[model samples]
Target: MRRQTARLYLAALSKYCGSRLGKLLGVGCGNGEFLAEASLKGFDVSGLDVSADAVQTTNTLLGREVARCSTIERAGLPDHHFDVCVCGYVIEHTREPLEFLSEVHHVLKPDGVLLLVTAASGSRPVTLENALLRTGFRSVEMMTSASRVLVLARARVRRPRPLVSVIVPVHNEHRTVARLLETLTAKELTGADKEIIVVESNSNDGSRVDVLRFAGTPGVQIVLQDRPLGKGSAVRQGLRHARGDIILIQDADLEYEIDDYDSVIEPVRTFQCAVVLGSRHSGNGKIRVFADQWLLGLVFNSGHVILTGLFNLLYRQALKDPWTMYKVFRSDCLHNLKFECNRFNFDVELLAKLIRKGHTPLEVPVNYRSRSFKEGKKIRVISDPWTWVWACLKYRVVSPYGGDCTRRTENEMGDVPDTP
Candidate 1:
């Protein structure tokens, strides 16, 4: 319980403090550090500060397209526009911390959060100040890290608390799994809202040993695969055992860069979106993404976007690329879905199922680094536009969520292995 609680509180601080409903007036928006971050994450932001210099700095930093002056908070900037009001290091220096907190509440959409991170006073603060913050808001909680506080009181944040499940699909990654287990063992996710579920598949590589080591960690559980299967299969099995309101899908390969659990859960913690796909196509991705394959790789990527785009649109779903990158989804969303292809093709099928069910998904661009062929590029000659397209079309016609899908009697397609 404590493990899950720790995660929930931490997620609340990192991602849930949007101007409540993403409608808000930010005071002391200096240089717009939080504002720019929010906007990049898809929030609608309007900001203000006592210093014009600060406002100029923000515009200078983020470019005019994304930065705007907030001296006009008087314009009311769309009333009830924020889900969480941001108070950076402002409270400690301000004469009226409480009134400023009140302003945060005012511009905040009712039920929005107030996120305050300031230097602790006099006697070196313990995590307990978060408790005192609830006095001014609705509820105050400290996340996994001791430096931040999530305050929600005046109005209730829609998801008073979110349940999150971290799913790691493991194969022969024993060395990496040890690090992952170490990380999961320390996560502060709790209160029936969090769990770290690792699904192990055929690992001639001893990866299962790493996962088994966490057999006793609170909220840490593992399910073993009966046979060697693809990464997607392990993900499906992990999801079946997941016990959280939100679910995350991550590769155990250790190539995807993620530093904090909060950064991992931020996408689904605050919004009603059905799924969030991590993109390597956004932001400073160039710094991390190297065009590893010099051949038809570029064409392969372009074709992937085109084919998946068509499949998604044909199913009425809008997405950039369904077959690549890490993905996160609501547990309920997957409950209504089905995976037609078990191997690489299943990635395409997931998007199809989502679209067929009328879900509009979102994206988050995170750091991505491609690996070398020596690092196991399981995708081979057959896993290209041909296979992706063939499987994509095959599922659209016969998969459970697709338009023409008629549940086949068990005797039909069961003979085919679920590899995608």
Candidate 2:
């Protein structure tokens, strides 16, 4: 009967987990039958039982110290360390079943699988499934074999492919807005789900008509403003309607390449960081300058260097291009924070507030093609610099969290609100 039960557990594991070659743990492993069998089947197996004799018998049978004599709660196991855990006929005997299941959930990896076995007459399947759900398990499946019930569940802590919200603040880019929208809405662009929010700020260059062409398209949201506000206003409006887990800012013009999206979003997607900036001058040796506007380019590039240096000094950061248009971040990073910039200075304000709030952005090298003034460059060369400087100075002193400028501790900083 023990051998037959071990075979049933292994079969269930294989069916649900696909591959059985990762780290596996057996809870209440009696006599080491399941542990020994799983080890032979290519799993790096370990076991824990409350009885010292059971642990000793298992270690002796396996010719090694593979079993520990302790309950799951007191075992002091590392979190997210196991790929698969088998609890064979153990849930019925646990004094605090919810706590036992939570400990198993804690130790299992994000994509880990849990197989629980109990007596058929112990509890109803629905009751067991609800308990598993409360303990952070999903896709709960129950199977009955003779007088035993087998429950299979997956950890809910796994990171699902996130929905990316691309906010395109359009001005007078009639020449590229339509093509940009088409490319953005393409299915082959990315594997993750995307929603394109086009905020057209009442363009007179027929850009409004171009944007209207994409209206009512699936997963495409169009917001038309009464008049031209600024990139910052458009972004704030888009945020009100954004429902994605990740938020990205995209320029309507073709200056920034769309091909760099994957590299820019990879770090945030993998949970390595919450904020990322697609820099135009990081890996590239020299900033790209248009041949026709050499003098204008020189002035702009010089301004960028000075402003970047000033920003780094003010914020105690080492960023290359803080004013880059390709900013990507998780939407929840904006929780309890308010934005008030309405012009080119918005970039400075946003970056300053984010850094102040403890989300230092990760910069990734990206391709950039500068457009000349004849192609509708928007920033005012003389006045915008002063506004940016003021923004840099103001945000450093003012509070983005409703006049609460107190710096958060490392533990307190992790409490971001849910994304809308």
Candidate 3:
């Protein structure tokens, strides 16, 4: 019966941990049978049992001093030292299950795996699963037979936090640029390391002076262009200087909330999606328009609906607010692609090309406060919509592969065509 159970434990380990074999600890290793089997399978095995007789028997069976007679809580094991831990029929006997699980958690490396075996009648799978989660285990799996339940879990691995490059394109609006910079530079706003790239396009409204104030600031790079270029042109310049794992686009205006940065970047950080767009109309059915400029708001909102619908149909997507300013994505996702649009149509071109390259963006709901033309809203109502339509059609049909017309090998940053 012990031999059969040892085989079962080994099988579970193989299924979860793959072919990788390393140091393994056996909790309450009875007579060293499981430890012996694990040792033969290329694992450097150690065992802990409270019973001195069992420990002696295990050492005698293995012909080595592998088993130690001590409780796991008082075992004096090194933290994050083991690769795999096998608790065979031991958890059910512990007085404090949470403490026992936590001790196990402490002894294993961040990427370590744990195999726990318990009697099916003694504990519920859901109860055990929850306890494992509380003890910092993720990717938990359970295998059940008629008599026993085998639980496989991995320790929550700590990956290095990614660097995020925030590209803020400044065009006029001195009133909000300084305040926006303050909110962005706050360290508590995000978990990832951040570098703020301010592309000042010779703003006539003193926005350049405000941006220049942060010139020597740590993690801030300021680029002063000779003349006022479009938002897309500024963003392209910022991209050349961006040195981040993830790239994010931010408008100089305060229409989008800085607080939503985490939510917008969460999908990319968690590896759930390659690209994320902070959609202002994700949950709200009503169109968000500037209340002060009601008539222009109505026209702009109507245009948004028409453009968004057209884009969705053309790209085979169901995205809400495709032209959102808050576009967050991994920098590598832009590899082998070229960007050309040098105006507001760049928004349409970027999203369309990304979709064509198989990166359907994940839309996350975000807070938005629309600003009117009087408040420095730069999008032209008449000509911009036509350009956006042309961009939607152009990028949708363009081949994503080959040639100077489609691909450019100039640099990893890709080519940005001059404004026509």
Candidate 4:
């Protein structure tokens, strides 16, 4: 009865926090009962108990000496070492519960979750919530059962969060290049490490100078091309230098808003998706185009719909706008495939390659502001459409260099690799 109750509560608590698998520190580990159950559930379990006998017994039973004879506040564990900190029926007995929580918070990595279980009296949920928030927790919630109160709180910032590489491909975007850098560098990205890699192609408008201004800035890499090689080539170069868990593509132009960055990176961060593409056609059914006042607008919209329809039919996937500049994907998806084109066909190639690898991108509605041709809009109606169509057909039928012609089912297409 005792082990069952502890296992049930711990399982529920772990699920409520995030997952059952991580480096877990169980405060007040008594006889290794709960930690044993947690270890079976895939947690890298360790323990702290004030009783030396209890700690020794736990270490003996678990077959390894993971349990230490120490209290929560003075356990002397390494900082930011654990993905989760669990205190079951220990906080209530601590001389200083606030200090205990602070210690636990210190040991947890940024974005790590802390689970607390205690008798459902004395320290009410309201008090516990305030205490946790005051000690650097971003959010806190409590669940009540017949005899226990379970609290879950996530650390405000992890010390070493996964880096997100932002690849900006630019050509003659001198006007907006500075603003783009400022926005990318100055934004407060919670629970994320950031790297900015800017690939600037040949531009006579002093765009190189604009990019050079951030030359020595931390976490920023600048690549200047002597001659214009097209956006695809610049992006491919940027991807080569990228060192991040998540790769995000941004345009040098200001048409796509930077404020949608959170939404763009969320799906990949939460592991809910392997690829997310921002759709210019997603929200309100209203769109902007360089020639909205002319027939070009109608032509562009029709082309988008027809091409997108064909893409869906061929790949058997639903993608709203595959041409959008705001595409975020896991770094692994780029593996085992080679990019041939260095032009705008890059977009079609990217989508086709990902689909062939069984990665279907989810579309998130993003805000878009169109620029007129006089306002520096690129891409002509006649030539680019043919290039896009050819890319779609070529990749759809022919095998990419060093790629498989046999398509795998969705299950075979693995998701993001697990992070311990």
What's the ranking of the predictions by lDDT, best on top?
2, 3, 4, 1
lDDT of 3 by residue, 86-157 (tens): 987888899999999999999998879998877778676656765775576766666555456677888874
User: Whose lDDT is greatest here?
Assistant: 2
Per-model tally of clashing residue pairs: 36, 0, 0, 2
Clashes of 1: 36
- Badly placed stretches (over 4 Å) of model 1 are 1-160, 187-193, 260-264, 283-293, 296-300, 316-318, 399-420
**lDDT tens digits by residue: candidate 4, 1-420:** 157756655655655565647898988888887788888888899999888999998999889989998886776789999988878788877788778788998999998888777776575554565567556674454556445666677786533566799999889888888998998888766667889999989788989989999999999999988888898999999999998877999988889988888898888776667689998885433465554465666667777888888888888887778888888986755754788788888988987887765566888988898777777877876798899888888888866534532222223322322110
Q: What is the C-alpha RMSD of each candidate to the true structure, in Å?
A: 19.5, 15.7, 13.1, 11.7
Question: Residue by residue across 214-299, what tens digits does model 1's lDDT show?
Answer: 88788788888888677678777777787666777767766676453455466555443557777666532132233665554555
- Give the runs in model 2 whose Cα sits over 4 Å from its true position: 1-160, 187-191, 282-285, 404-420
- What lDDT tens digits, residue by residue, belong to model 2 across residues 225-339? 9999899999989988898767889989999888899998888776667789998995543474868988888888888889889999999999999989999987656755778
Model 1, position 343, has a per-residue lDDT of 65
TM-score of each: 0.52, 0.61, 0.59, 0.59
The 10-residue segment with the lowest total lDDT in model 3: 411-420
Model 1, residue 362: what's the lDDT? 71
Q: Which ten contiguous residues of candidate 4 have the minimum total lDDT?
A: 411-420
